[model samples]
Target: MPTPNKPDFQPVLIVAGPTASGKSALALDMANTFDGVVINADSMQVYKELRVLSARPDDGELARAPHRLYGVLSGAEACSAGKWREMAMAEIAECHAKGKLPIITGGTGMYLNALTAGIAPIPDVPMRIRETVTAELAEMGHVAFFDKLKRDDPETAAKLDGNNTQRMIRAAEVFAHTGRGLASWHNEPVLTPPENMFFKKLCYMPPRDILYDRCNRRFDLMIAQGALDEVRDLIALNLPPTAPVMKAVGVRELSSYLSGTTDLETARDLSQRETRRYAKRQLTWFRHQMTDKEIIDTQYSESLADKLRHDINQFLLTTPK
Candidate 1:
């Protein structure tokens, strides 16, 4: 049955799950039944050039309702929670103005968290400082980075990996901006429960074995659908190796195949393995970080929609705006 809208409230519904776990389908079904806008929250699907590999919704699916923020970012630029938050906040404001429910769906936990609790301001590092850090990291290895961060902030150093250059740079940027470590900056109080908005957050997790099967099958399907060709075209641009999109899992594997470092089948297997690892990480994040949210175990599918409908209906007439 279709939902009947209430004028007094517009709740933001966020559906999150691991990749290829029917999040897009569920969001589409909700959009069809309710006057809602489907907003993309996945990190990779935002890139304009990555539609095929990112598993973005197809034209037929998008035609069902208004969708926003998909395929908007250029492939070269680094897209992060900060930029996503800026775009999402604007879209949310517009959705509210138009009196439509906003359904933010994705596998990216950081993006969803940024939507509710505003991200701690992130700033760009000075070019000189960044290059110097990168050079030092290259020459001395993570040991050098670890030593620097340890001297700078023992707490952040304790929690971080020396090999994670992006995170290391981010901590440095935070320190450079706020004169404190990223840990200290995060200590600042966050005023959340965003204005005039309430959310019913749900994470859809099927069993581990089933989820792994789906991941492998979906990745194979992606390869068959010209994901390799997509990467071929993307690499034709000859963007810097450090360009943001090149770092994505499948892209690197595809590049190895293109470079003759690995056979296509080997590359595909490697990609699938990495994707499974990523899904495992996402599952862990869902369990630990969102322990309080209502989680649907769609392992067997017998209770899937009943649980889904019950959860949605529970929020419909009762959750405060």
Candidate 2:
């Protein structure tokens, strides 16, 4: 393809990896080093109610550098990848205007892909259609709703798990309102980023054993940091079970404990296991979907940051080819 018009093109740096891979720390280091603004790309981190479970940057870390788009949404509102992309693009422009680099960081592959590769032009389903589909799914439950989705949009259903309540409802709403399967809409050309924006991607891929250990230890630390209280507050919101925040990795397991369905120890173990599984999936997605990025196969540390300085400096100074 012909090179995109180079004049005024802005460069963005991306720090992506699985949970507990230290991508956040790396982003903070980069922000302090490069006079950059760190923009949130993690879906959960955007919700105001999920700070503890989402492992969102704490006040001290936030004080180290400018951060944007973190904890900006209510858990009651769902944030789609396209929605996040819009918000992220605006933040990037703001950073560039202020003569600061934009450092995007997160483990949400879908959100990152939306920013880098763009997203399909899937129209928003009407509120009426969405409400109706959501109610129907709640009444029928996931298994039945998934079966209905299979009949209505088999291509989409085949790719989704029955337990992925939010996506299933989304698929149903799209099919009901548009008279076309969600999969078909995906086949349409995606709405990509402007040619004037370029991304320098970096992914962390810590060894599986170390990554899983970190996932387990992090949950323990979260509990110590009053994650149970966070879950309690979230439950008080009475958000629908399918609400995106409600489905965060620790929410369900911890909620089970609070509801007397499981003991604390069991909940803790299960939550840690789920966290590990989530990390594994994230690693797989980054490995496959972000193949053209620089890879760091070890955990982040001060030495790693020192080693990365030269490469990041080059990315900041050079124009995209």
Candidate 3:
């Protein structure tokens, strides 16, 4: 196959969609065609312990293409959007230097937003503040920890989901370190990609019912493939309960089963429900957050690669100089 010509100024191809939408397959096909490197954008896929649950590429897939940043972190290390962006930028630069396409594919809206739009430069939290917050969260639990965050940074707290303990703790830590709210940081000037960089965005927006069905079936497949064992090992590590990995879609549901709190059937049903809900949120985010970009709403087919190539060509042709 003839390699596609690289666009001037770091070129990036973003393939985004809800979970189980075949984004990875599309990315792999494109990479093979264009001498591209597949870089992960899924937050959960970054953890080494989540290989099965996070749906990281299998060994055969990884062998076929150059993949980066998948399963690179231990469960103990939380990967924030900022950290992921920094790592992605480095990988994209490496691909550019080698005259290869950097194809970033995942369902993580925040990570993609950080790459395409930019991110506010939130000040780093002091180690003391981080440690203090971690200790406090452990002692207080989520309810108490959240109450404290509401008191310290109510605006940020209000914006966050009630059960998003990781973010709530982060907000509290920021306030402890800088005496400033995370919401206020949003008003600061953001650091975005350079002016010359060109981004081609492709999103999959499969129908709701079909997407939900896929999610449910995939969860069943996951359990059959020893996802329970993966969760068992994660629980065995006894990482902090507030660790981001603990809240991963299947972990809690499966943990409940393993702990004798629920039956296997109930656990599977609950996990599927959560996965469907997550897919709904992802669709909403893509609809609103990426309104200007092209969305593929139909069923995926073998011609997807050709269709994508044509769409990308159109995007490039219409891009302002």
Candidate 4:
């Protein structure tokens, strides 16, 4: 059932989950039924060269309703969480201007977190500083680098997992560049929507074994759908090694096979394993960060829509404009 449109109200709906968890299907259904616009929140989906590997909406899916932000960026451009949040806010405003509900759907936890909690405006470190920090971390090893971070930016280090080398390096670099802790910058005023705004967030977590099966099946389908050719074209572009899309899930594994470093079987196995591991991390992040939101184990079932409709309707009715 569609929620009755009240004159002053604009809805923001967030559907988040692990990859291959059927988040897109549910978001499409909601967009069709509620006269909503589906907006991309997945970080990788923004890259134009990765349509097949990213599992972006197909022509048929786009024909069902309006979609925004997917495939809007080049592979050479890195889409950070803060940049994505800014783009999303603009999209949400446009949706409201058209009196359409905005439904953000993706598996990227940082993007979702930035939207809901507001992103900290960290200053950019100079290229030299960034390179210096990167080199130091590599030379000293992750353990020593993480220990140094704990000493210099204990507040930021306390919140980060020691194994998250990328973020740990970022925090260390911030301290090195500015002599200010990254966590302290996070305490500054955040850029977010007005105080009256609200978001109805939902997290989909299918059963572990079932979700793993879906991930494997989805990768197989992606291969059949010409993901290898997509990667080949992407590789021909010869983007930098540090390019964000180069690290996209299937890219490395498939590229190895294409380069004759591995067989198709090995590539497929490695991709599937990495995808399952990513899903596991997503599940953990959502479990810890989104404990207050509704958690649904869809198990790739269509039956969840009716309940979703009811929940959305209630949220629309009760949440003030």
Candidate 5:
């Protein structure tokens, strides 16, 4: 097969959708066609510990194309969007220099948004503050964490999701360090958009029923594929419960069950429910963060890849400068 003409301008192929919507397959197909490299955009995919659960590209897929940043982070490290953007910028520039397309795909909107449009310069929270807040969150849970934040800075609490512990801690950490809520800093100004003409955005959404089905089945599959043991190993490390990976849907549920705090069925149910909620958040993010992209429906997904191929070709043929 002949290669497509090298795009004269930077053209990033951003393939994003809810989980299990064939985003990876579409991205791989496009990479093969355009001699592209697939960069890890999913937050969980960054950790080397979650190979199957995070759905990192399989052996055959990685053999076919070079994938950057997948399974590279230690599970213990807190990987912020700022860190991801730094790594991805280097990878993207390398791909551009080599005249290869950089195909970016993931469900993590914060990471995607950070790269496509530039992010505000947020300082890293001090380790002492992180440990302190993480410990407090463990003892008090998110409710108390929210109460503390509301007392410390009511404005940040008003804007934040009470249950989002990860972000909540980050916000509190920022305040503890700079004495200013991140919300105020965010209103400062724009630096650049995530993409620089190089990105051709392709957004997709599976219907609610389909997405829920995927989330449920994937939960079962995770159990079948040793997700329990993975959590077992994680817990054995004696890391704090507040560690990000320790809170991943299946991990938390299974860890609870293993610790005899809950039964297996209840754990599985809660995992499925939380995963569905995560999917909903992803859908909302895509709908709001990006405007220029085309949205593809995967309700009738029997022809998903074919439809995606057609869309890419069509977009390539007609999209203007």
Candidate 6:
């Protein structure tokens, strides 16, 4: 396979879609064809403890192509979008220096948005403020805390799901520390992307029924591949509930089963349902948030690659270098 002609600025290929939509497979194929480096954009896949649950590229897949930013962090550490963007930017630059295309693949919309669209440079809230807000949330409960957030930062509160404790706490902390609503900071001018770099975006939007079925089957495969044991070991670490890894799709459901609070079948059913719902949410996000991408309406396969070959080649070979 021929490498892309050296361009003046980096050209990144982004393969984005809902979970179980085969983004990794497509990215691996593109890497082999274009002498590219496959870089992870998924939040969960970054955690070292979530191999099966995150559907991270298996050993065979990893060996077939160069990959970056996968399984680089411990589950105990929270990977905010800013943190991931910093890491991904380093990987992307390294790929460019090595004369390899950077193919970023994942389902995490926030991480993708941070990379491609830029994000607000909101100042970090003090740890003291974060702890205070968390304590208040614990004391007042989600309902009361959310009501307080509505009064204090209605713009942010209105956009959030009241049940999302982490976001609620974050909103409250931002307001407490800065005396400004989180939404206001978001509306501020954000860190801009590099002026010369270009992105070629591809998004998969498979039929809902087919996508849902795939989600179900994929969860079953996760179980067969030791997702339960993975969760067991993760739980043994006793990471805080607020840790992002603890909120992965199957983690809670499987944890319940591991603790003997639910049967394996019941846990599996709930996990599958949650996975489907998560996929639906992802589809909605990409549909509305990333309207500029080239949308492929089917799940990835060899035929899909064949179909996209000419267009991708045009992008790599014909674009300015």
Among all windows of 10 consecutive residues in model 6, the one with the lowest summed lDDT is 1-10
**Candidate 3 local lDDT, 144-237, one digit each (tens):** 8888788888889989986886688788887887889999888789979988677888898888888998998899989988999999999999
In order of listing, the candidates' clash counts read 0, 0, 0, 0, 10, 0
Pairs clashing within candidate 1: none
lDDT head-to-head 1 vs 2, winner = 2
Model 6 RMSD, rounded to 1 decimal: 3.1
Question: Could you give candidate 2's per-residue lDDT for residues 1-321 as a string of tens digits?
Answer: 112245476888999999999899988888888889999999999999989999999999999999999999998887888889889999998987777889999999999998888899777664556768989987998888899999989999999988887788889999998989999999999989878787889898899999999999999999999999999999999877657889899999999999999999999999999999999999989988885799999767778888887788876666666
Instruction: Give candidate 6's error at residue 117 in angstroms.
Output: 1.1
Q: Which residue runs does candidate 4 get wrong by more than 4 Å?
A: 1-8, 123-165, 172-184, 299-303
RMSD of each: 3.4, 4.0, 3.5, 3.5, 4.0, 3.1
Estimate candidate 1's alpha-carbon lDDT, on a 0 to 1 scale: 0.78
* TM-score for each candidate, following the candidate numbering: 0.85, 0.87, 0.86, 0.85, 0.81, 0.88
Worst 10-residue lDDT window for candidate 1 reads 1-10
lDDT of 4 by residue, 77-182 (tens): 7677888888998999898888788999999988888888877887656545666787888899989999999999999999999999789878987899889999
State candidate 6's TM-score.
0.88
Task: Give the winner by TM-score: 2 or 3.
Answer: 2
